[model samples]
Target: MGKKEKSYALGVDVGGSHITVGVVDLVSRTIDQKRLERHPVDSKGSLTEILEAWAGAIEPFCQHEVLSTVQIGIAMPGPFDYDAGISFIDSTQDKYESLYRKNVKDLLAKKLGVSNAQVRFKNDAACFLQGEVFAGIAKGYKRAIGMTLGTGAGTAYYHGTEAHDAARWGEEYGDSIAEEYFSTRWFAKKYQEATGKELSGVRELVDMKEESWVQAIFKEFGQNLGKFLVKFASEENAEIIVLGGSIAHSSALFLPETEQVLSRSLPGVPIKKSILGEESALIGAASCWYEA
Candidate 1:
């Protein structure tokens, strides 16, 4: 008799603000019991505690008997030594000690008892873009760029499931091309300075009830987003650009302005909002394991 096909594997996404965990069934082409768990970055929690939260949130799915392999994918913030699967850089969460070292991948795999399993780690933006391609707005498009407009902006290029050996990916050094001066955080900073309102995140800044109040912020964001896309278009010559983030989801607030600006600057290349919400990373992580 032929060997039975493996069941499902779990995919986990760890962002600066939250974590998402899901189970993906390959043959069925469906996601099961996807969960979004929020965890803030803090100068607290030991390495074990942090990981326990990550593992524990996703553990329920692994208990399913049909899963042949416990595949785990992590979409982390930047500057990781992906080849070594290590996050050498420390997060703001460093208390008296840092959480991880050279063997984070090893540690995670061991803790999960996934010694023989596949564990992949890459920039969160790349995973976000991958999610865009897998289930978000960029599906079927071979060449595309995905920009995550969040606390900091991040961009990654992908040609379908494969990334074209990125010459530059998002990093703190300036967010490089992702540094759209008009990001929501940028707007909050400028709005707070210009309007004198202490706002939480950009979400409050773009409440949309007051269009005129937010017009300048949206306009500036459009200009910057447009300019950056033009540069990317010149380089990657991509056909589409996808955006995924909380800020991106509020397309009602700023996307029209963004579209108008890109239309003027980027002629043929099109810009689109992310269909996959915050769950994009979770979906992307699941795609990673399901594809392999």
Candidate 2:
């Protein structure tokens, strides 16, 4: 009898300033935390430079001569065509300017010496929820909402069996998006507006949770987040909401108020923090193929 072939998938998480890749075991739907490869990318650099850096980060996981039947799934940020694999981010963003209107799938496949068909792209936010639905907190939930609270509010909804992008819903907020009030930038901005002290990010503000002003800031943030959720929960019919990303790490600072608000308004829906942490994206990226 022929030897049973091993199945694996290369999952890549491409962020604004970094790229992380992993080799996920198909059957297990998980990646080795130790074997995961991460590298910083200069989004402001030339497209060739960024692509090369992404390829380089992934190469370490593909060192073996052959990865028979291995598939590639990339959790990519949007404002682009996911099906066409094109990037729409422009110079105005101060990042990925060189890749504006570029066919990312083909170019990335070429850089990695893989057939274009072997690569698939999905919104990073959807992948985040997908990862959670596959093996994290939402594993058994029939429906759920997921958000990444970082530079922006990356949102997704999982229904039936797949995660779908719900980021567009953020547009309802204002000229910018819901992210304007739901992200770390919002936290920083609110903090500075009140204290007149500039902060690099939410971590600094979280560290000062002991201060009454900081506590009030987070409480208000939680209330804002809860209000946002109330608007979407009914439309999404989500049974639970899970939060990930840099800001979510400080859930203790804000979750109490968030839960209180939800309990009063939305009621039954549960709000939880991501259990998989960083690995969720990698696993979720790989799940793109697994679920297909």
Candidate 3:
């Protein structure tokens, strides 16, 4: 087999409450995935354990294949010392031991026995953006921005040939404004207030399919994102912007408002929903493995 086909790439996305891993034959655009493997990351579990668990979770999917070399791409939460691959989880909201967590990239490689494996990492949200631009709705757009609305708001900018990357001003000032506005938490809270029910979670509200409540919450989300995009696009002069993540699925409720606001404030900035679905991260992260 050719060297290109022999080297398989692995992508690892570690999120606020879960770890997802994927193996891809980028040469043929073939992929395998393991999703949402929840860990006690916020509990007593060590970062070492979390890393190993993620590696092990992906091993079985590739065992039956003929992969000769491995490269790993890790997507992490930001404000991490990315150059050094050291990160601290938002233990305030999650369950990591912020004071004791170690270098996740090193640990993942060691536990997988790919200690010398080529690896690259960026903010998890950036991976989603890269995934979108590489093969999703935003493909071929040379200048664009990506925003993911989920547990929290996330934003990434792609300019020139450099695709997805962690924000230099992220995970700190990020949470103070737009990130706090478009989050699913707000939807849940609004739903709770609208229904006079102390929600167990957003899932409950989503199940109700209450149009009024949903529209109100998503309108706020769109307004927040639109305001943020106005600032971001004017600064970067991007051509297009896309949204992804779980909340993006509800674009019907948010898109019109978002577009309306963007049209009024930014005039010509084009914005749309991501087409990568959930696989964008896996593909983008795996593609980074090849680039590395």
Candidate 3 per-residue lDDT over residues 29-62, each given as its tens digit: 4465433333324333666566656666756644
Clashing pairs in 2: none
Q: Which candidate gets the maximum TM-score versus the true structure?
A: 2
The Cα local distance difference test for each model comes to 0.65, 0.83, 0.67
User: Can you give the lDDT of residue 168 in candidate 3?
Assistant: 28
Please write out the lDDT profile of model 1 over residues 115-169, one tens digit for every residue.
6346777677787777777766787888898777776667788865554224343
Q: What is residue 173's positional error in candidate 3, in angstroms?
A: 10
For residue 137, give model 1's deviation from the true position in Å.
2.0
What's the C-alpha lDDT at position 280 in model 1?
69
Error of 2 at 123 (Å): 0.6
Please give the RMSD to the true structure for each candidate, in Å: 3.6, 2.3, 3.7
Per-model TM-score on C-alpha atoms: 0.84, 0.93, 0.82
Residue by residue across 1-292, what tens digits does model 2's lDDT show? Answer: 1244445788899888999888887677678777788899999999899989988998767666364345888998878788889999887667788899999999988888877877889988998988888879888999899989888788899886889889753566644678787887788788789878788889888777889988888888888788788777768998999999999999888898888888887789999899988878878888777733
Error of 1 at 41 (Å): 6.8
